[model samples]
Structures are given as structure tokens and as C-alpha cells.
Target: MAKSKFLAAASHDLRQPMQSLFFVFTALERHVGTDAGQALLERLGQGLGALKDLLDSLLDVSKLDAGAIVPELADVPIGPLIDETAACFAPAAAAKGLRLLRDAACDVAVRSDRTLLGRIIRNLMENAIRYTEAGEVRIRCRPAADGVRVEIADTGIGIPPEHLDRIWEEFHQIGNQERDRSQGLGLGLAIVQRLSRLLGHPVEVHSVPGTGSVFSILLPAASRPLGAETRRTGPAADRAGDASGLGRVALAIDDDAIVLMGLRSMLEDRGYEVLAASSGDEAIAALERSGLTPDIVVTDYRLRNGQVGTDCLLRIQEFLGRKVPGVVLTGETGQDIVSEIVALGFGAAHKPITGAEMRAAIERQMARHAGASASPVPEESRVAEPA
Candidate 1:
């Protein structure tokens, strides 16, 4: 508990600056046209990506330790998942002159949490690409008796037999003795192991030292027939191109001035009319004074004076006398907090959220609000706040 609390606090503090940097860089990228500027931006983006990975790894370990992650299982199509995961790592593989191949010929559905499953596969692929100096990384799916086995094979530096069992231990990196940040913090496999156990999936590894490695995850097959056409959805970044929150008013609440500024700048860049405040009361007061109804609310999870983002959202909605779509931005990785946010039916975007992610969440919430408005009673109207 102590460790979790410390990590949560540290993550929240660290992410504030990171989040601000992301917004600033994104804003800069828009005006940067020269090759030198583009190159510099790419390097900065890579640095930010590394920082995000480290922070994410720490939070993930904490969440697993606290048993914060609850898998939402469903009949997830295999082909689309494989396709999407492969596409995500295509750029990295291409950068290394490696091919990312996906053999999704098996038209099967897996009974697992799609998000968690994707995390596992993505980690494996990243690990594969990171370790492999040459050759290709291939993802192949095959039918098993109880379910399907998805194997991530790579022609990289394989793990030794003696070290295989210990690789899943937190901070255990094979061949990275110098503790190089570029090699990753060695938390990927640990997260994969915990998530797999949580989802009741069996994870297997086969490797020949100095040759290659294959990580396989056995996921139970869904008790449903395969559909002729599988719905394909890309990452939020990819889907955000057409979704704009332009001309929509957004209210942001956060105690941190830097975070509030970043949110304001980023939202404004995306054409959103933004109003920012430091607390729930302030946000409500602003709304009451201006008589402005916000189409969407964005807030930090933890606020001043023992308040929280959810309360701010609810207060704003109550003041507006209507349901408003909300996005809860936070660095907190506690299961209880995340559960509460989800229970409130609000969208969640973790701290240090990329421009694309923030945009996607805003767009998603706007769509939801539009749908709710079309209904007889708005969804938020039915949401009963706790006494």
C-alpha cells in the first residue's frame, strides 16, 4: 500500500510536466516545416515516448501489485486484433529494417479482455523488436483445443534457459547490464505475465540463446461463431483524423496551473472553446456566472481541497441542468479510482496524454453527448451520485 501510494503520487507529479511538454511539442510540430525542425521534433517525440513508457511501466506494476486491473472479457475477434497490433509496430520494425508479419488466417474469437490482450501482444512485439538486431518479427495465430495460441516470434537475441524463468521478474532485463534506458525498464514482460494471469491465459516462451525467441499466449476461444466480416478499428491516433471538437465548448478543472495551461492550449489548438478552473467549486462558479453550458468537461482526477474530478464533472452537469460528456484526465493508477471513474460513465485519459489521444477522447465524448441528447432522457440524468 505504501509503495502504491508513493508511486501514484510520484507518477502524478512527473506526468504534469510531461503532459505540458507534450502539448507544447504538439503545438510546435504544427508550425515546424523545415527538415531540421522536423528531425528535431522527431527526436523530441521519441524522448517523450520513452518517458511515457517508463511512467506507464511503473504505474502498471503498481496496478498489478494492488490488483487494480479488472479484465473486461468479451468475444474478441482474432484477425482484427492481430492486424491492429501488427500495424501499430510496423513503423518501429521498418525503422530497424525488419518486417512485421501477421498471419491472421485463423478466423477465431478469443474470450478475453481486448485491451489487456492487446497490451500483452504489444509488449511482446516491442520486446521482440527491441532485442532483435536483424531479421523479422512475425505474429502467427493457430487454433488450439480450448482456444487459440498467438505466437510472437522474432529473430533476435534469445534468452538463456537459466534466465527464462526470471525474465518475467520486475526490472529484469536480459543482456542490458548497464541499465540502459533505451533497452526499456524491463517491465513489459512483468506486465504481460500479470495481465495474462488476471485473464486466465497461459503464457509460454521458447528461445535459443543468440538465435531467437517465441512468446506465445494461449487465450480461450469464445463460444461464438466467426463472423464473415470482422470490424476493424485503429488506434485513437489513427481514428482522430476526421473527428474534430471544433466550435464545441469544453470546461477543464485542475489544480495544477501547468496542466491547466497545457489542456487549455491543446484544446484551443483543436478549435475547442475552453474554460479552465482550479477546482470543482470554481468550475461550477464559472459556469453559474457565465451561464455557459459546456458540451464537454475535462478534469484532473485529484483536485484541491479534498475534491476530485468526478465531483467537478457532476457539479458542472448539475449546474447546467443537463448531461454533459466528461473526460477524466489523471495520473492515478489505483484500481479503486479507475473503477469509480468508469462507474461514473466518464471517459478516461491518463496523464501525459498525447494530443491525438486527447482529441480522440473529446471526439468520443462529444459523440456520446450527441447520442444522449437525442434520447428522451440524457444518460447523466439517470446517473445517481453517491450520498
Candidate 2:
């Protein structure tokens, strides 16, 4: 309990700066024209991404420890999931001169939670590519006696026999004693282990110190074969080529001046007319002064003077005599807090959110609000606040 609280507090503080930097970098991406400058920026972006990954790993551990992740089992086709995950990491493998191979012919389906299973595959593949300095990383699916075995094989520096079991422990890196961020924070396998256990999947690892390593997961076969599966794309994919905020007015509030500035800049870049503020009163005042109804509201979850984003959003809606699409930006990962935010009929996004992610959240909320406007107010939004 003490450790979780400390981790949450530290993460909240660190994510503020990371969020500001993300917004700044997104706004800067369009200005770099020279090849050399672009390359430097890309390297910086990779480093930033690594930092974000490490923080996310910490949050995952905390969430798992808190029993916040509940699995929803279904018939998950293995082929398409592997294909999508492989596509995401193909660039990383190519950058390291490693071949990423997959058994695309396998059409087997497994009964498991798709998101959790995909996370397992992703962590294993990331771990494989990180340790392997040469050769190829291949993912193969084969039939097992009672289930299917998905294996990731890598030809690089293999793990020692004695350290095989210890590798699953948190912050236990094989060769990285210096705690290099580039190599990773050593939390990937820890997360994989926790998630695999949660999903009732068994994990296995074998390595020859000088040759290579292979990691496998055993998943139960689906009772029935999969029918035609439609890929589940999140809000980002739905608005892939249409990220423009043209003619849309947005009201943003944040206590941190830097974060507020970054938000304003990012929204402006997306062609939004922004009304920015640092507090609820300021936001209301700005709205009244502008005499323009904002199409969306974006605010930090915790604000100055004991103000919360949900209340601020509701207050704004009350003043305008209508519900406006709102997205609450927070650094808190407590499940109760998240559930409360969702109960308020507002979209929720964790801190250190990238520019693209923020855009997606805004669009998703706006789309939901548009759909709900034609009907009565959602019952969830009318629930009384918890004491």
C-alpha cells in the first residue's frame, strides 16, 4: 500500500512535465524540414517514447497489484492479432537490422481476453528484440496437446540457465546493470508474467547462454472456430486522416502554466479556436466574455482551489444550458477515480498523453456527445457524486 501510494505520487509529478513535452514535440514536428534536423528530432522522440513506456509499465504493475484489470474472455483469432502487433513493431526490428518473422498461415483461435493476450505477445516480442543484437526474431503458433503454444524465438545474447527464473522478477535485467533507459526498465517481463497469470495462460522460457532464447505461452483453444472477424479499431483509427479541428471551438483548463500553453499551442495547430484558462472561474469568465459556445471542453482532472474536472464540466454545461463534449485529463490511475470520471458522462485520459492520443479522446467525446444530444441525457451522468 505504501509503495503504491508513493509510485502514484511520483508518477503524477513526473507525468506533468512529460505531458508538456509531448505537446511541445507534436507542435514542433511540422517545423523541421532539413533531413539532419528531422533525424535528431526522431531520436529525441524515441527517447521520449522510451520514458513513456517505462512510466506505463509502472502504472501497469500498480494496476495489476490493485486488482483493477478484469479480463473479458472471448474467441480471439490468433492470426490477425499477431499480424497487427507485428506490423506495429516491424519498423523497430528493421531499424536494428533484425528480421521479424511470423507464421501467417496459422488460423487458430483461442479463448481469452484479446487485449490482455495482445499485451502478452507485445511484451514478449519487445523483450526478444531488445536483448537480441543480431539475427532474427520469429513468432510461431503451433498446436499443443490441450491448447496452442505461441513462441517467440530470438537469436541474440541468450539468458543463463540459473537466471531464467529470476528474469521474471521486477527490475531484474540480465546485462543492464547501469539501468539504461534505452535497454528498458526491466518491467516488461514482470507485466507479462502478471498478465499471463491473470488470464490463466502459462509462460515458458528456454535459453542457451551463447546461442539464443525462446519464450512461449500456452493458450486454451476456442471451443468453436472463429467466424469472420472484424478488426477492432479504437478512436484513433476511426479519425485517421481527419484530425482537423477546423471551425471547432475548444475550451482548455490546466493549473500548470506550461501545460496550459502546450495545450493551447497544440489545439491552435489543429485549427481550433481555443479559450484557455487556469481555473473553473476563469474558464466560465472566458466563455462569457467570448459569447461563443465551445464545442468541446478539455481540463486537467485535479485543479486549483479544490476544483475537479467533472464538476467544472458540469458547471459549464449548467451555465450553457446544454451538455458539451468534455475530456478529463488525469495522472491518477486509481480505478475508483476512473470509474467516477466515466460515470460523469465525460471521456477520461491518463496523463503524459501524446498529442495524437489527446486528439482522439477529444474526438471520441465529441462524437458521443453528438449522438447523445439527439436523445435525453445519459443516466450515468445524472448519478450523484460519492461522498
Candidate 3:
């Protein structure tokens, strides 16, 4: 517990500067136009991306160890969730010249936390794709007596029988004795084990030395029908290109000046009219001075003077005399914080957000509230999962 808490606090602090670095990178990406400069920038982006991935994994491990994540069980439709997750990895799989396939998932509903389950599937898919050199990665879903069984199979290097048990241990990887970061930090399966245990899902693995491997998880089937509000919510990478916030007004709130400046620059670069503020009062004043209502509200979860992003969003809505699409950004992994952000109909994303992530979050909220005349808060909102 002590170690977990310490890591969590340290990771939270690290995310601040990490976010600033991402902002700086975003601002810099627009200026380098030459092929050589772009190549260097791409290399730099890869390094930064690797760093971000490591930090995110470490944060997940610490949060899970500290029991900071709570599963919000729901009747999540397996088909859409699987399809959406698979789509996100399509680009990566294609880059490796591997075929990614999903068997026609039946209209099966699972009784589990949707977000956690998606994470489990994503981690397994990523592992399969990373370890595989050629052939294909396939996903299948079918009805089982125990529950709905979802399996991901890969034509990659298989695990040895003796080492199967140790794969769930942290930093355990086969064939990669050099500890290659490209092979991943070996925390994906560890996270999968912890999440499966928390959700009471049974995970099974089968493999042969050089042929391939299969990973499966059995989720308890939901007896009730799917609710009207139940739907897939995640980063639409395919649609991100069209999610430009052009000609729209965006209000960005954060206490950190560097983050605020970087964010403003990034958004302005994306062709949005941005109003940046360091606090609730400043935000309100800025909005009032602009004499233009904002199309979206983006704010950090924690602010100076003991304020929270949720309260600030509400205050803005009250001041505007209507509910506006909002997104809450934070590095905190506590369930209570995430729950509050979602329950209030605000989109949520972890801190150190990239320009793509921020834009996706904004696009999602705006689409959700589009064409409504000051619609009340929706019943459920899914936070943006890690890319």
C-alpha cells in the first residue's frame, strides 16, 4: 500500500511536466516542413510516445495495486466494444503487414465494467500483435455455458509451458532478453490479470512453442436487455480527421501556465477560436469579454485554490444559462473522481493529453449534445480510454 501510494503521487507529479512536454511538441510539430526536419520530428515523436506509454503503464500498475480503480458493472454489448477496440489497433496491425480479423460477434451482452473489459481486450490484442512477426491476429466471441467467451488468437511466437505461469508476473517476457521497449514493458498481461481478477472474469491461455498462442476470457452474461443509453464511446481515430474544431469557440481552463499556453497554441493551430484561463473566475471573465458563447469547455480536474474542474464546469453552465459540452482532464486515477466526471455528462481524459486526444474528446461531447436545446445531463458517459 505504501509503495503504491508513493508511486501514484510521484506519477501524478510527473504527468504535469509530461503534459507540458506534449504541448510543446504539439506546438513544434507545425513548424518543421522539410523532409529531414520531419524525419527528425517523427523520431522525436516516437521517443516521446514511448515515454508516455511507459508512464501510463506505470500509473495503471500503481493504481491497480492501490485498489484505486473500482469496476462499474454494466450490461456492455460485446460486439460493439470488440469492434471498436479492434478498429483502434487496425492501423498498428496493418503497419506490421498482419491481418486483423474478428469473427461475427453475436449480440452478446456481458455483465462487467465496459471500460475495464475494453482495456483487457486491448492489452491482449496489443501483446499478440507485438509478439507476432507474420500471419494474422483474430478475435472470436461465442456463447459458453459459463458465460460469453471472447478469445484473441495470434500467429506469433508462442510461450513455453514452464513459463506460462510467470507471464502474469510483471516484467516477464520471453525471447526478448534484451528488454526491448518496442516489445512492450511486459506490464500488459499483468494488468490483464489484475483487471480480470477484479471483474471476476476467468482468463485462459493456450500456446505451442513456435506456432501461435490464444488468450481467452469468460465474462458472465448479462440477463437483462441492453439499456437505451448503453453505447460504444471511445476515441474515433477513423473520424479524428474530420473532428476539426474550426470556426468554433473553445474555452480551456488550467492552473498551470505552461500547460495553458501550450494548449492554447495547439488549439489555435487546429483553427479554433481559443479562450484560455487559469481559473473559474478568469474563465468566466474571458468568456464574458469575448461576447461569444463557447462551443466546448475543456478544463483540468484539479486547479489552484482547491477548486475542481467539475465544479467549474457547472459554474460555467449556470453562468451561461444552459448546459454546454464539457471535458475534464486529470492525471488522477481514483474512481470517485472519474465517476463524478462521467456522472455529470462531461467527457474525461487523462492528463498529458495530445492534440489528437483533446480534439477527439471535444468532438465526442459536442456530437452527444448536438441539436439539443440545452439538453440535461445524459445518464452515462464513458471516459476516453488510453490510445
Model 3 score (lDDT): 0.86
Please give the CA lDDT of all the candidate structures.
0.82, 0.85, 0.86
Go through the candidates in order and give the clash count of each: 0, 0, 0
Cα lDDT for residue 54, model 3? 79
TM-score of each: 0.87, 0.87, 0.86
The lDDT-based order of candidates, best leading, equals 3, 2, 1
lDDT of 2 by residue, 105-125 (tens): 568788899889999999999
Candidate 2: worst 10 consecutive residues by lDDT? 231-240
Q: How does residue 100 of candidate 1 score in lDDT?
A: 85
Per-residue lDDT of candidate 3, residues 1-387 (tens digit)? 787788788888888899988888888888889999999988988888888887888899998998888888988888888898789999999999999999985576889998899999999999999989899999999889967999999999899999999999988999789988988998899999999998999999999989999999999988686565555553442243247778888899999898888888888887889999999889889989988789889899999988888888887776776789899989996878988899888989897777778778777888887788975433232122113
Pairs clashing within candidate 2: none
TM-score of 1: 0.87
lDDT of 1 by residue, 159-271 (tens): 99999999999889988899999888989999999998899999999999988999999989886866654344425433433365676788988888877877788788878
Pairs of residues at least 3 apart in sequence or in different chains that clash in candidate 1: none
Task: Evaluate model 3: give its TM-score.
Answer: 0.86
